[model samples]
Target: MQNFKAMVLLQIIISIFLFLSQASSQGIGDKSNVPEYAWLAGNWSGNGFGGTSEESWSLPSPDGTMMGMYRHLDSMGNITFYEFLLLDETGIRLKHFRPDLIGWETKEDFVTFEMVRYNGKIIELKGLIFKRKSENEMEILLKLRKGDVVKTEVFTMKKINKLK
Candidate 1:
């Protein structure tokens, strides 16, 4: 019985070690071949997060940077929150703000999501994935973390000429 218990403890320890290693490596990836996000450039909106979610992306600029912005609204069309997104050689960094443009984090802090997979149509970031369903349609999956809990939000958005 003693030997069996010891073996079980050893196995648990090994499992935990492996899990920690993988978790720590989540946002680290090869940045040399970050593809241009021309497919994602446009205005996108859909139902998400208890209301409507909108995202606007800019084409790759001559300075080699892509910019985006996001906004979430309530059913009544009241602004709930906003986010500024940027993609560059480093990674995708985003900052959250309230409707009044008050930041949610410290001035120097922003959430960074690293690119993990890209195969033309599908681009997977550390905790976010963009799947191009068609030229005018896209599926976005975002992993939101709070404390020890994690939730995934799926948004299906279509390209629009402007935000509605």
Candidate 2:
């Protein structure tokens, strides 16, 4: 009887802990403490990889999620690839796809990028950086790593919409 009571108490404690943890995560996922990146909500086009790169970010929703999309066209103006991005207080989650919408990663896999810094003017992810140059110009610096070789690729983007 004593062992049964102890087990029941332990289970209750574990349940409470799990509940609190989940609640905390939800709270953090909201805008309670996340920086304002709404300025990024617009169409932006850039040049890189010998092609033109276009990206668009949506305004954050009530649930604190911002959706972003990216596509690159070759110098000949042929579509090359696409990327879908999900942004939240924690970081950015991204997935790659071919022009046909076929995924580069498995359905269960995505690339996670943690924010290194964000100060309204600049946002830095683990291996990527977004720096606002002016009201309508932004620069993107990406660090590409392979084996032991790391290369930096820079993209200069101009916001397509009238600056808000």
Candidate 3:
């Protein structure tokens, strides 16, 4: 009778372990679903804050990674600054680069914005948010802070071309 009780207890423990393992695996698999914001994959241009800006985005990969490049040009069409962007399950990462390929951040450091929320057309990433206004239009809101001063900027983008 003692041997039978021990065997039953061991079986129950094994079953519970298997169940927990399967549940954890499923939760991880769900993160790979491509975000509906994939609609951002395209060439976009706009004028804002005294400059003309152009941005290009790539469609999200199966693993939920999307890449983007941005250029800010003066009214005379001279390049002012550039930015590289990445979106993934971890969050949104941004790095500023000069026209000469010099990076603003250290080789091991980049700005990260944790994803706070998302719907089919809008994604909020901490202080930065993006909203798809329509098939050809989008809006970006950025909140910047320096010591005790805070500033907010809004940019409206119009689709210039769709990604192939």
Q: What's the C-alpha lDDT at position 75 in model 3?
A: 85
Per-candidate clashes come to 0, 0, 0
Whole-model Cα lDDT per candidate? Answer: 0.82, 0.86, 0.85
Write out the backbone clash pairs for model 1.
Answer: none
For candidate 3, which ten residues in a row score worst on lDDT?
A: 25-34
Error of 3 at 44 (Å): 0.9
For candidate 3, write residues 28-146 as lDDT tens digits: 24654657667788999987667898989997776678999999999889888898999876678989888888999999999999988776788888898889999999998889898
In candidate 2, which residue ranges exceed 4 Å CA deviation?
A: 1-34, 162-164
Q: Please, what are the lDDT tens digits per residue for candidate 1 over residues 1-164?
A: 99999999999999999999866665224233334555677799898998999999886564447799999999999999999999764558999999999999899999999977666598788899889998789999999989999999999898986321
- TM-scores of the candidates in the order shown: 0.73, 0.76, 0.76
Better of 1 and 3 by lDDT: 3
Where is the poorest 10-residue window by lDDT in model 1? 27-36
> Residue 85 of model 3: what lDDT?
93
How many clashes (backbone atoms < 3 Å, residues ≥3 apart in a chain or on different chains) does model 2 have?
Answer: 0
